[model samples]
Target: MNEPGGSGGAEGVRLQKVLAGAGLGSRRACEELIAQGRVQVDGEVVREQGMRVDPTTVVLHVDGMRVQLDPDLVTIALHKPKGVVSSMHDEKGRPDLSGLVADRRVFHVGRLDADSEGLLLLTNDGELAHRLAHPSYEVTKTYVVTVEGRVKPGVGQALKRGIELDDGPVRVDAYTVLETSPRRSLVQVDLHEGRNRIVRRMFDAVGHPVTRLVRTRIGPVRLGQLKPGQTRVVAGNELGALMAAVDL
Candidate 1:
């Protein structure tokens, strides 16, 4: 049921695959959403897992809401502040990253918790967002953390080796106690996994609570000198570097 010239095969493609490629979720999750009567096509609720769509002509919906496919995509980087959530809106009426950007349609490539700050990416490219956010891609994220206690000797090594997370084993790609003193320290942690609350949990596992966590880099893109609440369009080479980093 595909219209000709769609990026994925237009002739025959599974509906869940299309939704997942559109960054709604993984294919399996999309199937569950479909089963729960949450997905629709061409204004009709579609529960069939194998339903086909022609990207050129078909319209998709989820939960009675249209999911428009973006033809003109934009990607931007924002220096997110700690208080802003990484969402378009918060029902509790809290401020979110969307308040700082001019493009209202852009979605975040990945999310930072409301209390986490630093290099947050905003984009309308669903496939790119999926690639960047998925754990299998293993895009390296770099964070500078100020901890409450001085890092014990070999703590960095311990982090690099592995830490026991609630989900499973997690390890940093690179870990270093950059600056250490009697009572506090600045630690640099690099990870390919984007697990929830990973950096904070890793530090907590080591008995050093994270006082502040700011992600300085994500793959080839860096937060740089951008002040909090500032944002900029991702330029040519920088954008290319990021895509390359994710093997897009």
Candidate 2:
């Protein structure tokens, strides 16, 4: 019904082609999905054989999942190394996030201070970036920390119970001691708080000052085998789960 008596042919690309190009499937398979009334454009199901859509301007959903088609939009995951600033431009002239993604006009989704490093995402998609970075969204981040002196099991328990900070009480969603020795300890922590230098401050407050910190995970994305100072495009299942996380 969206074909509009063949006027759709004069403008926009074919819907099935757009879907297939989006990695949904082959053209025939996308056509089958459209015929099954599972392809939607701007919230309306289109069952026409040759429905055309301006992908950049239309919200396309297949089987209730969004399909991003704007070629201008991108999201990149960077394993930021220590000493690199998260800002796109640094007046201090130190290496920055923009140099890492020189090809894309994007900004870092969240800040990873120069002292700490791990999975950092940069994106030109404003909505996706806002949703991922906003405090209203309870997206947990996992950090592996090394601190002075051995951390006891009690500290982990106390963290879960919540610790009082200058601003307010801070609590971890999860914490585990990965290693402990006489001089130093290693631990993994998960929290949703995005306050400035929060993890370090929390450990300091508990008497185990953090010596090293690396954020290992942010929601569905992982650092994995990505070495320091490397980046990969965020797409496919990972992208799907991310958008699903923030209701994009």
Candidate 3:
């Protein structure tokens, strides 16, 4: 196997050493992976050794999946509780996501209203956060909603077909009525847009105002078994898939 090219200066960490530090394996084992051309530095496959990369600025991938090398940059999935705001700071003095990651310099990717609850991501990686929240990426957000009154037939169809909100035409990627009673109905829906109170507005338009809302998933990451106010670091293969969603 031929030696890998350098990032030109001697200022950065060695690729194999960095890989080892990232828990891939012993330094020698990481070098073997490098020798086999399984390592990619900023999208280019590199082989052999002696390549130096700035983990802070350079992107690395093994087998076409992006790897996280910077310890400072992290993404967090927080199960926001009802009445908690998504912002890091709330002047109103209510509980907010800031207390959750007070030790890290992170910002929420999107907002979950004070009344809404469920999966919300916070990260210090600006590019990843921007892409994930951008409308063009269309990262679908899944939510379970309880609405007032029984859900009438064809409401799902009407939402699937698209409803014109005051902002514009809105449509759900998927919708299912989970349960219904005379006074309340439960349903789940998927959407990519993040307009202010979009889910609540959508239901209201259909004549069923949302009584309770809880997000369950965002793209491939699920809230899972996390209870209210719980949080987990988003890492490993799950992190890779998330970055891929935004073409990072």
Best by lDDT: 3
Off by over 4 Å in 1: 1-71
TM-score: model 1 vs. ground truth: 0.70
Task: Give the better candidate number (1 or 3) by lDDT.
Answer: 3
Give candidate 3's whole-model lDDT: 0.88
Cα lDDT tens digits for candidate 2, 1-248: 55422235468888899889988899999999999999777777889867777776777777767787876778888999999998999999999987788767888888888999899988889999999889988898999999999887699889999999999999999998889999999999999999999999999999999888999889888988888888999886677778877876
Q: Each model's number of backbone clashes?
A: 3, 0, 0
**What tens digits encode model 1's per-residue C-alpha lDDT throughout 108-162?**
8778888889999988877779999887888999999999877888888888889
For model 2, how big is the CA root-mean-square deviation? 3.0
lDDT on C-alpha atoms for all candidate structures: 0.80, 0.87, 0.88
Better of 1 and 3 by TM-score: 3
Per-residue lDDT over 1-248 for candidate 3, one digit per residue giving the tens place of the 0 to 100 score: 42233456677789999889876789999899899989888778888488887777778787666788878889999999999987788898998887877677889998889999999998999989999989999999999999999999999999999999999989999999999999999999999989999999999999999999999999889999999888899987788788878877
Where's the lowest-lDDT run of ten residues in candidate 1?
Answer: 1-10
Deviation of model 2 at 56, angstroms: 2.6
